[model samples]
Target: MRATTTLFSLSLLLAVSARNTYRSVLTDCLNTASVPILLTSTTGWADEIEPYNLRFTPAPSVVAIPRTQAEVQSAVKCAHANKIRVSVKGGGHSYGAYGLSGTLVLDMAEFQTVNLDQTTKIATVGAGVRLGNMANKLFSLGKRGVPHGTCEGVGIGGHATLGGFGLDSRLWGLTVDTISSVTAVLANGTAVTASASQNKELFWALRGAGPGFAVVTSFKLKTFAAPAVNINWSYTYSFPTPAAAATAFQIAQTWGQQSAPKELGYGIMLFPGNAFIVRGVYYGAKAKYDALIAPLLAKLKTAHGGVEPTKSVKTLGWIDSLTDLAGAALATPARGYDAHDTFYAKSIVTAESAPLSFEALTALFTYLYTVVPPSSAQWMIIANLYGGPGSVINSLPASTDPSSTSSYAHRTAGYVFQLYAYTANSLPPFDADIIPLVEGMVTAMGEEAADLPAYAPYADPELGQAEAQVRYWGDGVARLKVIKAQVDPMGILYNPQGF
Candidate 1:
């Protein structure tokens, strides 16, 4: 009788708790400022709730789609005043369900818009705009940017805040470098604009550390004049000999260091099939580009011999080429991707580190093949050649908030090495099979890996907040902490990095 009574009371308590939770989330969501409330059974609710990686399911009682910065400001204010958990959503591309796990998710997908100033070459873009949309729209207006990630559907919010890299990066710079100003809603529900001249410290923090601080409503970026870009070649080589493949990679790196122009960006890839592929874009005229890349052509074996530059389309509009970089054709402009981006990466290969380069890299690649089978899909590595016209990243002041660190510091100058883990299927094999290989490789690299810094946007959350601080803020973590205390003293924001 005593056990039965206790069981009955527990059941009753659970029922009441669930009811309260649902009611609280619903009430707070409905009261959000200038936003539309989304309920469980609403049409398209399921679609809106899906995240970029399709890894986790959201458990929000309600989703609030805000259409303007004012709405974002209002939503933040309401959540704080009502003591409800708030999460901001832009493109739903974040892994680990960061945006959609709260009592109320502020969906900014409806806030997609791009307003460009042709005269000044500046773009004030909506927080929710996807890279594909922004790039395509900008192309139509005869301009382009540093190009976004290869994946089409990546949201600007996650991409920009994490330090974006793309084809034009060698010539221009990372996406964050071009940012002019930002409009964000703070923890206390106050709306503020941050830039170089005003709230300078806050502006610095927002560059790479922004997402953890506030909900970005909009951004003003310094845009560049669009020009025709020449994509010279795409070649794939499968090597039977691992040593030969590593030699080719080393040669390519050497050539890239010596001959590749700033206007040209080359990328290297090590495939699951033991193939080493090299692809690149030429930012200058075709004739000069061909001449500059002669060394790469010479290095290829007779069996792998040839250069295939697009003949009819020798030169492509800046935006169009960005699409082409995604392997999209001119006719089918709608090609897109749903992507989850994180860089489990280490340093670049330079002379000082060349002694261990061959062993370290080959071991890493061989391990990848063993863990992630060739049949496994959804990933690639992007080894970008940095140091060119826009190669001033290393020149920034050491105290600059988002200063570039030495993960890819192997370049006598520097470069960016990224590991792309692409898995179309969510199965036991990936977490069990693939992730361990990655972790093990990083471990094998040991002190060499520790010397490398992770990209904020792409750092694995598994490392928890400590690793994030080292990756994004580096030595600037102290300054970020001061700002976090002043702006969000109560820590109302849900920082995965733990600030």
Candidate 2:
């Protein structure tokens, strides 16, 4: 079996050639390119690499910092020719082995340039550029971008590849919808550019296929006129039961459909604390926004005394809004820990599945809290609807990872529920500590909890069985395998999730 061979190769490599394998590969790849490469053998390299969670670690191999698209192409081709595995890293923010495990890591650290085309309202961003940096750059030019979440350090390459969701997803759409083009290095070491007119299938695959399929060197995205000051406020309230939380969450969703405008976006967070946090943004007049949310506000006030009609609002430049959302000032980079990620993700909002999913979430959160240390524990259970013109899939065809996959036998009704877990501790018997908690939650939920589709970005190798694969991807797996055969027949660019 392929797994058996991989395990054997790993054992042999560690026993017979452990000391010099990675260094030799790095040296050969750098020599072939005949260019300067950054080599970090110890502390400095370890220090700069920080994942969102502590479970993932950068591979032991030395990383190369590429500044230009040409450099990226050369790096990929050289690695391919040398039989070395290649992974493209942007900001090193991905919380799994995709960014860290094996082979050569093509660090995009030097690829941090954002060029704006004011004439056409398009921005050409380097793959290595972080969203936080891009937002700041666009602010200087008086432009704004589609929503892609609040993480200031996430790179467009990874986020865009996974169907970026953010405040604007409910309004302007996901990050992928605004993508005009991508210049990427393929598995065969060939450099290619994809758009509607060019390599279109590859273009479609790249949007939500995750980074291993190709190494994105640059992304061209459409931009909009920057808002002077965006207003945001959140109301948090406690509920007595899972049914109560689910009903209230559904009410908010109904309200969004009836009254929220294209310029407004909001999120509902249902937590185990028997609490629901309703947070929203307004791109227009405050009075207009207030009027639209009044009904929901009134319902909340009547049901929950803690619910207040008063709102705390802040006004800042478009870039400032990103920083505020990132909680950058409050959150410092984590240190001395191991972090990893897996998702109990779903994509539909059917009435039958929603109730069961809601009940399952309570158990899931309780399980995580019991295992993951509180100081080091952080989880984001995000539920957002995507249907309006502002929805990520509104402009693009379905099939994007975060978008619906018609290939699925079970129909999707255009909604996304993302269960994110973060921890800063690395205890002994890591698997024993975390696996039981996660597996137990899944077992407790049983068959009624289907809502998410496959995760191209957060692939879990442990779940390699047929049932697990089907549960994660359904028919999408079949489609991806076909694409993988076409694009990476040699299987050189190997990752747990990729073909």
Candidate 3:
């Protein structure tokens, strides 16, 4: 018995020694590599490791900040050699912090560079560049623009790869639709450029399922001439009861179904104060804008039963229009990307075939006002109008849509429903209570919309792996899996819901 105990102790000691040796070897390799690595003991390690969402704080084995493509290659090689997992972080805007984990983190903050070619109107942007900065840069240089998200802090790498939707998506299509080419490093530390004609399969996967396959360094995106003038319009109506709110929602739903002009973008925001607001933007003269919105205003007035919206409209330059849309949130450093806040967000794409039911809409608003805590940092329901008739995105055939080759499978959706719950403090029962409510809201939406799938870019970890796969990829899952196996046979790049 004593001899057996001694043998067991010796085996445990050998295992510990082996682990220590492995860690030491990896640390030494990273330290002596072509690029500098930030160890846990380093001075700026905390800042580099901090993600946009404070909810997820992972202690990675090492944080690597690469300044160039070669450095990125070096970092990947070192991690691969040591058999350590790797997660790539661009703008760090993932609400669930998928950009971070207990593995090695490749911080791309230092690779932010945007260059534009006026002749071809092609902008080459680093993966680390944020949407707001990119838009501002394009406007200043050549009055150019790209279809991107409203939140300026979102990174191009994750956003474009996962079907980027934005205010002007109806006009120009998604950010991925503008991508002309990509330069990325593969799982084996080999860098390659992908386009429609070159590395065709990789190109298709990179358009949507990029994070799961490669570490993208830069993108060559096609740009368009910015509108000469942009007109912003807003209307807010206070509903005294759930019935009134339901009536307003019904009216808005009918109006949304109408075939509006391609230049017009519209949506509704249901705030915590039982306020239903209709907001839109027109990329043309006031005369045309007024003519287009006249029917909407009349219908809203009639259905609202004498409750009128406080209306406002303004005309501004392209840059100012973006600033107005983003509001004061633009002034925050990194566009509020580094704010320490905790939040839960889930999104679904609703098709015109299955609209939100009156019962579900009523229940949603009632629950929002009654059960949600008043002290919550932020809570709101946002519905963005997309895939409108005559929309460039809708005009494309299903086979030609961006979702065809990529994993983004919600091309037919007309509106995106987002449920958000935020809190600054970590109080007890926050997750236990709020998370289920959020899920319930999404579940209700799914029921009303015929079990439609959720958007991939939102990245809800609460949705188990199998459900997330179906919701994000749908029929494209099999193809994505095959490509993932071929490209990353060893499964190097990974995330909670990633391939």
Best by lDDT: 3
lDDT of 2 by residue, 143-194 (tens): 6565676877676777887667677666666776678788888877688988
What's the distance in Å from true for residue 498, model 2?
2.2
Model 2 clashing-pair count: 15
How are the candidates ranked when ordered by TM-score, highest leading? 3, 1, 2
Candidate 1 stretches with Cα past 4 Å from truth are 1-29, 32-34, 300-314, 328-356, 368-379, 388-392, 399-413, 424-431, 444-446
Question: Which candidate ranks first by TM-score, i.e. highest?
Answer: 3
Which residue pairs in model 1 clash with each other? Answer: 52-92, 342-458, 378-422, 378-423, 379-422
The TM-score, computed over Cα atoms with residue i paired to residue i, of candidate 3 is 0.91
lDDT of 1 by residue, 375-461 (tens): 354455657765533443433444442443211211233445656554445432334344554466566545665556555656465
lDDT of 1 at 182: 87
Clashes of each: 5, 15, 0
By lDDT, the candidates rank as 3, 1, 2
Local distance difference test scores for all models = 0.64, 0.61, 0.77
